[model samples]
Target: MAKDYSLMEDSNRSSNRSIHDISDPSRRIVLRGGLGMAIGRLLAPVAAGSAGCASGARGDGPLLGFSSVPVSTADKVVVPEGYIAQVIAAWGEPVGLYGETPAFKFDGSNSAAEQEAQMGMHHDGMHFYAQDGSRSGLLVMNHEYADDGLLHADGMKTWTAEKVRKSQAAHGVSVIEVEQQGDDGWQVVRPSPWARRITACTPMSFGGPAAGHALLRTAADPAGRRPLGTLSNCGSGITPWGTYLTCEENFSSYFNGPEKPSPHERRWGLRKGGAGCRWHEFDERFDATRHPNEPNRFGWIVEIDPFDPGSTPVKRTALGRATHEGATVAVTRDGRAVVYMGEDARFEYIYKFVSREKIKPRGLRENAQLLDHGTLYVARFDADGRGRWIALGHGQGPLTAENGFADQGEVLVKTRQASDLLGATKMDRPEWIAVGPDGWVYCTLTNNSNRGTQGEGVDAANPRRNNTTGHILRWKEEGDVDGTRFRWTHFVLAGDPANERVEAQGNIKGDAFGCPDGLWADGRGVLWVQTDMSPSAMGKGDLTRLGNNAMLAADPHTGEIRRFLVGPVGCEVTGATGTPDGRTLFVNIQHPGERPSGRSDPEQPGRYSNWPDARAGGRPRSATVVIRKADGGPIGT
Candidate 1:
């Protein structure tokens, strides 16, 4: 039977779970862009509903090349008949460091020093960047968090300074150099100068209006311009200009707030006691009462330079903060850079940032400043397939002193407040979004069990009740992507193919999926969807036939979805990307055998999933897997 949903879930635990805490005022702001005018753009509807997958035609990409694999409760990775998967990097694999590299310890005895140069835990969103024209490249990945039971020799029940430090070193991003080995395999380039790890202890700086804001001040950096690290990074994106965008989600649970919580802090899920991870017990900075503004420093989209590991990662503030899922870049016809983002909490809003200046392709440094100044907007979706982007800038409307927004900096720091006042449409837990080749946007509303039954009921956009299965939403800008108006529709109401709800909406043919989380569109207009379903639901109910969390391929044009690969037991399929040539595919299998009722006592054998190891007494580890066809053909062809 499924566990009581509310009791089994903590504020710290959610789909793609990451945590932090905070509090603020409830003042309202004005909406600058007229919603009435925005509706006019959608009146003339177009026929482009789902993505156009060119692969269906002759001489295009492959046409669902392999048969669908059956659902299994086995502890092994499963793929279509012609495809093969190989593990590349795991939790403790050493990449490279300032000094010498150390070997990974399977006994969980590796010191904090070793972890600095090793791959972090809970591999999440990632992207592959070709460096040597597809022969070799950099694979940038996010380490969501560490599993206390597996990270420590004796578990988190008896925490110490070293254990805390080791965990901290395991919660950021990894940029490792990978080179092709054989026709369909790749290996990590160990000790390569290009391989490096950015942990929660790495030094980082801030950019945009909120860089020097008072809310960001801390004893270590009174200027409030620099923060010590990044944590709770969930989903991510790769920018057109070559930087990696790693989003900080659910950061509110990181801080242990004051004795009396403020309304804002409560809303952000700040707890009086330390967060579940208990980092505050070792580092006072995590205690919000001691460092009141520390929690404010997180919850922003951080950009990292994969090619230059020595360069500092930056928290881009022009894109307002919340529980940021990630940021996707879309370039307009005139060269402007537009970023679409989703705040990943239930009822949170979707947002976008339009750069003030056009993109400069001269050099990285020449174009780095483009993201420093942009107009941020919150989305408001209507029941009639229309939507508007409300400007979140200062001097726009009611964003004055009366509304608690002193300036643009204040508006960004309190982004959720600003959007609430503007009446932005509340969405289900929105996660990663993909932009098809034709410019239509596809987003994953990864379920919202907390939704009420009435006004927020089944509408043209979010059409479901107690949406445990979730759905995919798509929209297109009538003119410029930065324009205030757009047309929207429900592309797929994800669920069992046999069910009436899914049959009436979803365009699935081969394999069906639920709780779509990580979404990306390859250059060929194929939409890749990754699943993140609850462990109990994996083999029961409408999802019983779906087996483990798997990655599916969907033709944007026909809306046909086919299961491409299924992960090991207890794993969440996320962090998917392919090489520039599309011959090699990289997908992360996170927290395999992480079932809520699974064994966790180290003294016992096969405590969870043996996974990639497939041994009788092996422990589960989150690792990045490489997938390719046996014939060395392009993936998902």
Candidate 2:
């Protein structure tokens, strides 16, 4: 018989699992052009709902540990009464003495050089280093993107040269030393020696299939060996050898291009005619002429050695570049590392990279280089629990010149195109994916809001969209991550049971959730479900804007999805990892309030997301939340 996981699940994971922690108070502030509209845009909806939740508790429902509630008001975590959480690091902690973060100069005036020393905003995905904090390993996190005009001193100005340059630098990753402060909490070690920032200017090398290809060569990199910038660093992965791998998401939108591009550019959806991001106006490097092969260089999984500050990060091209949302890896039973990845755009495809050489956990050197050479494959799943991994091999199979696909090299260079050639099912905006130690791989089909309408399809994988309340897909690798086939199923459809949309997806039969974005299975195999992109209240079909975003733990065996903790208004829950002991769970909350949607108050002056800051009222900060069991035991029901 299968192991009865429910017996091993944390008891009452639901008690402290739910709490009412919503609070609303308008703070007078300055506005950046885009952020000034937040009040008017949200006041009628969000603030109104928050007001209702504050008017006193309606029935919290059963203590099945399933209710999702707002953050605690007592300056501590508010879970179902059985769980607890604490603040680990906030924005602007003394991370590597960037001189006290220079007050998040939101204006686009800061130079690229200065921005590198400061922590990037909107920290999304992060990983806790198994190595001791003192031993060089640090928590490496993706800053995603500097939201609105935050991260600048006088507020973003002119979106000009210096400002754009500053924006670029503020978009990578921050590595900081953190250690357990107690049985269940973690804190950053000030002035950490291992703390470092990987910005757009950081020196990096290329790896994998397209490392030195002609497509990757730019005027600045004639040899096609080095790429200077990294942008839109989204979710990430950590190899068994202990290096951090961050992927670039939405890179296609960064550059502006022609309606229909050349074959190569079209493979990745770039316009053949021009540059994107308007960075060309201020910096020639952004121009294709100056860097003809530049665009092809991004969209690959870039690896950073957190253990070596001086090491040059490597972009593993073999993984195939696209709008890489995130990378998650599982060590197959045979010791090879299988990296699970996604392309985070509507109708994008999911991918996996399996190394030819088996992984040795202690072989840091080999493991570090393992991602350099590999065969990348995209995924196609069926609702009935079975699927196939059609190989988009380089010169292999039907991917040949005769059939319109020229070669393996071309396949690597034009990944999406190759996946299309092989009939890889177009998926909902696939995001972060995680593999459980028990050998089950779980993925989040973030949302396919525009799939069908945009000439995309209702594929077996991405079944629905505006799919306001997304679902979680899970599969078990057949023998290994490299297997050509597997079993799959929609594990959970997110929504609120009390709401009508919940009934629409049939999740009301179990649990109602919205936008299942982040998926992480603990060492003991408890899956954590996080919500994002919940639609506007009401019109949301069966889904409603119940709360900002939240984190929940699910017992795969029992079908029980209990709410963990909800975030403040206008934020997304992302980037999760646990201390080795599993008692402390670290979570990232990003872009609270999106800075009021437009305008700037001249007096206060910071446009957008005053959260995690004092001026925005409350903490007004974007910080990582740490949760633990009250008894200091492993959590996740």
Pick the TM-score winner: 1
Tens digits of per-residue lDDT, candidate 2, 1-637, equal 0001111111111111000011000111111111000111112221111111101111233223334455321222356566776775665554665344444433334455666666676778888775662222367899876643344444444456776676677678888887765554567776766878887768899877677777778877888889987878878877655677898875654555455556555555565323224566677665544455677777778988887777888988878877887787665545666677887665567888878877654546746667766678877764344677776686677688886655555677678767766656666667877664334566787554443444443343333424545566666667555788876555556555565432235352344567778777655445677766532332245544354567777666556666777776556778887665555678888765443333223334433335555353222346788777676555552
User: What is the lDDT, from 0 to 100, of the residue 606 in candidate 1?
Assistant: 44
Local distance difference test, per candidate? 0.73, 0.60
Q: Model 1: per-residue lDDT, tens digit, 1-637?
A: 1122342212311121010010000111111111111111111111011111212222454545567777666777888888888998988888865465787766678888888888998899898777787778888999887777777767666888898899889889999999997654798887788888888889999999999998888998999998989988898976656778899987876678877877556656677763467788989899988898888888999988888878999999999888888787776656667788987777777899988987666546776777889899988776556678999988778787788888889899888777777877777778898875444677888876665332344433323545667777777787877889987766667777665554223344557788889987664556788998867566765566667888888765555678878888878889887776667788999888775653255554245577777665467788999888888877776
Worst 10 residues of 2 by lDDT: 16-25
Candidate 2 ranges with C-alpha deviation above 4 Å: 1-78, 82-84, 97-114, 132-137, 153-157, 182-185, 263-267, 271-277, 382-384, 402-406, 452-466, 498-511, 534-542, 595-609, 616-620, 629-631
What is the overall TM-score of model 2 with all chains considered together? 0.80
How many residue-pair clashes does candidate 1 contain? 18
State in Å the error of residue 397, model 1.
2.6
